[model samples]
Target: MEFDLSWPVLWNGLFWPLIRLTFFISVGLLVGNLIESLQWTRYAAKLADPLARRARLGDISAASFTMAFFSGITANTMLSEAHEKGEISDRELILSNLFNSLPTYFLHLPTIFFIAAPFIGSAAAVYVGLTAFAAIIRTMAIVFSGKFLLPPIKEGCLPCRLDEMEKKRDTKSALQKTWARFKKRLPKVLYLTCPIYTLFFVFKQIGMFAWLQGFMSGSASFFTFLPPEALGIVVFHMAAEFTAGLAAAGAMISDTSLTQTQVILALMLGNVLSSPMRAFRHQFPYYAGIFRPRMAFKLILYNQVTRGLTIALVGTAYALLMT
Candidate 1:
């Protein structure tokens, strides 16, 4: 078997994706660090105060809600510690945790958008936007529930002067920090991105996607709502990781076989359907460790259900609008 390694295949498959993604990641890290250094993360904590107050949670949760955007486990740890110490009631604990959903989305939006644009291009914006919308809905729902269920309190539920909050104001200058963040994030980006795109390219070269496309051809009839060519994207999205799904969708998009709405909806469906299992696998055990098992089960279950419904409803509406 003489190897058929050719320049076209190598350039298209490996070099281009790597270079594009690396450039995007570099720019993304720069923007991400700049945004963080500007006190946006701390600002998020201050903004969450009203919601936390409405939820009747301790001021501590305001801090936790802000942290959730940048680091979920850290936020959860703070909330869990408050619960353990009898500072917040069960309802407050759950509601406050739920309220952090929006913050978490905002926390990572810069990174997601910057990297997504280069690979998925503009369509990446739609999917990320939909998810962000869902997070907003989830936060709103939590707010309404908190306002209606919890009684009004007089004391300041807001934490002390947020101005004093550790700004993570590193000693390094902005340029140094941006360079450091870019360096720190590159490995993770490459790890997640390079292998997936390369493998998909190999699969393309070997006709695996073609075979799967044929096998999955009935998508026009089955999915009905989406373009037929989107079958590969849906299959890869559901069967493999999200980047794989995005890779497949991006290919179809470049060829103009699938519309942006179809790509968004397909990825949305994958996200909704995959969310529960993902929550069980990742959140349940983690939550159990933080809270007691029973409480953890309840918290994770609520989070999963709220998230799934939000995504499904928003995605369905978008799909219908597209149709």
Candidate 2:
């Protein structure tokens, strides 16, 4: 098939999404990082006290995860920086992130359910209930795992003398330090966010959505038992970005005969499965700067594995509950 390949369509579809993505990601990174840094610096010294640092790390990690649960991009960036700065260890960082991912998925619970409830009519309760149950159970798993199974630090892991001195000589106030760090990181964050935006726009412009829909529709026949939209979402999830998967699910739910539960499941699975790839796109660079490529890869691998297992378990539970 000969494509139009016109400039106007390209700009409208590709350029716009790209621009919007860049703007949102940039704003998220800047504001999120600044707030996190302020909180960290303000409490770091106090928490880092000889009597408090260890306990503080746990609390901070939990708080970070909670923030991330609500919003992934910003919180993940902040927590990764914290990990690099020795505020938290590798295990704690990974566990915190994994724990946060499920909550983040449910952050839109009220909105999603509210929207789906009217559309699905009475069946909405089963859909929402199953999804909520799954999220809660997954969160509990992360919490229990973090509390008992997470590794303990080796003796003298915290820099007692250095921490004390740093706490004593806090020259710049928390707000000042936060602003300084924000300024320093702003350029890099924009540079990264801009390209992602551009790419998103380009993908949209090139009729990628149409192609994805056709391909997924064809494949849906093979997985006839599962909801076509859900299967389609999983397929698009593997090939494209999370937004693509979400868009596909939204379109399918509106047009196709998919249940609300199926749509939510697809969206959740698409999001969870696509995380490793997304992290590679955004987080790998920051991580690589702090550690070698190999080390960064290992860290990402650890994160993906932990996150995947948690998501899978939750998804399974949701599916079972739905049945």
Candidate 3:
């Protein structure tokens, strides 16, 4: 069947993607800034003493991982800033960020399941539960490993000293500070949103996504001998944002011959594979400015390696348990 390419249909497809992206990006900016001001700053201050070096390392690692797992884009920016300020060394910063990315896999599962429930019926519950369980397990693994995984801090480097000239800000005024930060982030949110919306619409109108999905399908078939639906999902995932990839996966869930476990595995794999591309498209420039290109590359590579190993191990265990 020839798909309709009418203006109305195009507009309909573009509407949700645009709205969702803008809303999430805006929320990410506001909430992210507030999180930084309150929680992050306090954490930094609490661990600023020389005696708390080990504790500081763990806190930094956990926080970086939490942010990455929950929200990669915002978390990555925060990590870069943290590294620049020397709160953490380049190596530690990268390891923490990478470790956190794995947990992010399960972070969005609840929302994704709720959104998919209407279409997939009861099976949505199973998918959501399994994915959430996987994420929790991964989080635990990282936490346990964090005790030994992080390298020792350099001797004589006083715990990220706050200069005497830099007076502490009033933490009690959180609401006001949050509002101010939100206002400041408004322009940046719009800056990213406008281009993202425009590109999303233009791609939809040109049928670019379909062609890209087709290419993915072909590749998946060639490599994994999987059917079109699985391949299409993996492809959409690689080529587009998470929401777009999930939407494509949802569309094919009922029609595909793959088992539930297979579908979930495919989706998870797609999420992992898409990370580097997503980082390159959105984060590289920001990080490049703070750290030299070589430093940025090393940081990202370290992150990917750590995250990849964590995910592979955790994903294998999850698959084994489910099977």
Which predicted model would earn the best TM-score?
Answer: 1
Q: Tell me each candidate's TM-score.
A: 0.64, 0.60, 0.54
Name the lDDT value of residue 97 in candidate 1.
83
lDDT of 1 by residue, 199-315 (tens): 656665776645554454334346766666665676676556677778888887788887788778878876765556556643553455445668877887888899989998999
Cα lDDT of model 2 by residue, 1-323, tens digit: 44555777766655565566555555656656666644543343334233222323354554555565456666566666677678777767666665555567577777766665654454446555655665565556666665465655444433443354455444357557767776776676556555544554445456674565455435444645566557877777656755565566667667865766787667556656556656665555444433445656776787677656656677677778888
Supply the global lDDT for candidate 2: 0.58
lDDT of 2 at 232: 78
How far off is residue 177 in model 2, in Å?
A: 2.2
Candidate 3: list runs displaced more than 4 Å. Answer: 1-40, 43-78, 102-107, 129-217, 222-258, 272-279, 282-323
Best-first order by TM-score:
1, 2, 3
Give the lDDT of residue 315 in candidate 3. Answer: 57
- Model 1: lowest-lDDT 10 consecutive positions: 212-221
lDDT per model, in order?
0.68, 0.58, 0.58
Best by lDDT: 1
Cα RMSD to native, each candidate? 10.2, 6.7, 7.2
